[model samples]
Target: MRKNSSTTFVFIVLFLFAALIFVFRMQLVGISGMITNFSRPLQAGLFSVFNHPSNETNKKFQQVVDTLVSQAQMNQLKSDNNALRDQFATANIEPSQLLPSRIIGLPQFLPGISLPEQLILDQGTNQGVQKGMPVIIKNVLIGEITKVESATSLVTLISSPNFLFTAQTQNTNTLGIVKGEGADKVVLVNVELSDTLKIGDIVVTKGDKNLTGKGLPPGLVVGKISAINKSPSALYQSAAIQNPIDITKVSEVFIMLK
Candidate 1:
């Protein structure tokens, strides 16, 4: 009977313990939810601090990149300006008379095959650029402004097939018509047979001005005569002219303002 009484006491203790646990289950769930809510923001803040590509970090990185880009652009502009100043001093041209322009585009062609016919300049009508204006580097005539836009211009190089200008030998004053034959080849054509032609003669522009005074200035070096073609049967003799500077390599030039 005593053993039976002891087993009944143990069962009572177990039942009371289960009843207490059931009564507190909802409170325990509420406490767990409160803890999760409180830690969520803290966890997120810590993660952001450790992460390399957070929103704040990205904004700072972008600001740094923008600053670098602006600095590089400013440096390039300064360099271009300095180069133009040097060129003006070397050419003995008044700064007010020449508009400095950067070559923004080059004619596309295969290397070692042909020469460029035209160059695209950064300055245009908005910068006082006009068509038929002479483009030069130092004292050498490179091309003329054939077309103009608001912010850009096209220069037809001296080696273009359509280029035509009157030129004279610097030493002898032997006059001939300068014509372009492509592939960086220029020819002094329509020369009289009696005019003295030499292989090493330097040709220069015989300046011509229109009523508006927009034209090439005299004494701009064109090129040196490479070979003389004097055919006895032909009425006029021609000579091949070689430019001292490679037009394709030119990065800057000046436009003579009218």
Candidate 2:
């Protein structure tokens, strides 16, 4: 009976081992599908902690863009200031030529038939600007001051009706008085009917002390001789000049501070 018991114990031990193996295989198969449910959440939590940024990404991007925009604006302002400084240096040496100033008012691109063209500037007596100063546009003399305030001034064109300039004709080297002819034209008076005087003769300022403005710069452009009278010319006293500054389309002007 003891031998029979021993054999039965051995058989029970083998069956238990086989049953444990089968249960283990079944557990492994069951865990394969639910393994994702368990491991994926843990993996995602770790990734959030280690891989992703804790701060707002969009906000950071906006800050970077704003910084770049501000830098660009500052650069533009710096460039503008540098250009103005260079212009100032050039203007000071030749104060009679032009002084850099701002356009405070532009009454007309093309004002009207009744009203003459006019432009107001931010420079006046405050910045050494004085009456009769020739205002230049892009280095070309365009007009003269009509009025002045403490910090502002008005420029009237040489094409204006009441304008006059003493000019020296290049052909004859003779002096003449240039008076406006109301329609972008001027009269060069006291021109001798020499063989030198002809159509297309260039006219420039004679640079006399009295003919220049009281506080204005002289030797600026007056006009060009567009036509001349002949038929033995009846010994006329004047020649017609084509004014240079087109009064209808002036944008910027520099006031001379001589």
Candidate 3:
């Protein structure tokens, strides 16, 4: 009878232990889930820290790139300044008489099909730039200021249809009226038929003080004579001028301030 009683007691203890386990199962599962969720975020954070560059590293890299770009721009500006100084010296022009200007905009046209007839400069009336000021690259006349605002100016290129100036040949001193036919075609017309015309003659500004004042200085190179058209029945001859510098490629220029 005592042995049977002890077996009953063991069975009762086992039953109570199973009841406690069942009652606490949900709480145990919740604790385990909480621990797993906490560890997941920690693991992800560590992985990101190891796999990706830090914000400071990215910032430093960007700073290095910016410095390189700034240095390149500085070098380019220095080169341009040196070139302008050399050109001024060669042209016998005083640097003080020139207001260095940057080309901010180019005339819109189909590339390789059309030519530029105008340019926008960064200087305007605020910089003492005014209409009728001659724009040049060294001793080569490119255009003149036609309009000015407070901070910008409009330049009408020598190749514009409305552009007209007096020019003369360097070799023969033959005088003619320079006219623009658009599309980068400039012509020297009204030349007397008896005047000597050559294929390689250099054309320069005739420098009329009464007509344009200091706007178009004398001896400024306009272009070279590429072709001459003459007719026995015509009253005058015309010559095709080839500009030395491609106006489309010009980035910087000087405005005669005097």
The per-residue C-alpha lDDT of model 1 at residue 89 equals: 32
lDDT for each residue of candidate 2 in 1-258, tens digit (9 for 90 to 100): 999999999999998987997877554534443553454445445433433322465445446434533443444355457769887532122334468865545453343443355666666566777777778754345678888665567787666676776767554566777776555666787666564666665565555555343533434455567776654646745678775454433334577665
lDDT of 1 by residue, 1-258 (tens): 999999999999998887887887543545544554454456445433433345665555446434533443444355457768887532232343888886666655663355678877777666888899999866678899998766667899898896999888755669999998877789999999999998877787877667987667766778779999999999999999987656544556889885
- Taken over the whole model, the C-alpha lDDT of each candidate is 0.73, 0.59, 0.74
Show where candidate 3 strays beyond 4 Å: 1-96, 111-113, 211-215
The alpha-carbon lDDT assigned to residue 67 of candidate 2 equals 51
In model 3, pairs of residues that clash are none
lDDT of 3 by residue, 1-258 (tens): 999999999999998887888887544545544554454455445434433545676556446434533443444355457768887532243344889986766645674357778887777666899889899876678899998765667899898996998988866779999998888889999999999988877788877766444548766777779999999899999999986656544556899887
> In candidate 2, which residue pairs get closer than 3 Å at backbone N, Cα or C atoms, i.e. clash?
230-233
Say which candidate scores most in lDDT: 3
The model with the greater lDDT, 1 or 2, is 1
In model 2, where is the ten-residue run with the lowest total lDDT?
88-97
lDDT, ranked from best to worst: 3, 1, 2
- Residue 78 CA displacement from its true place in model 1, Å: 38
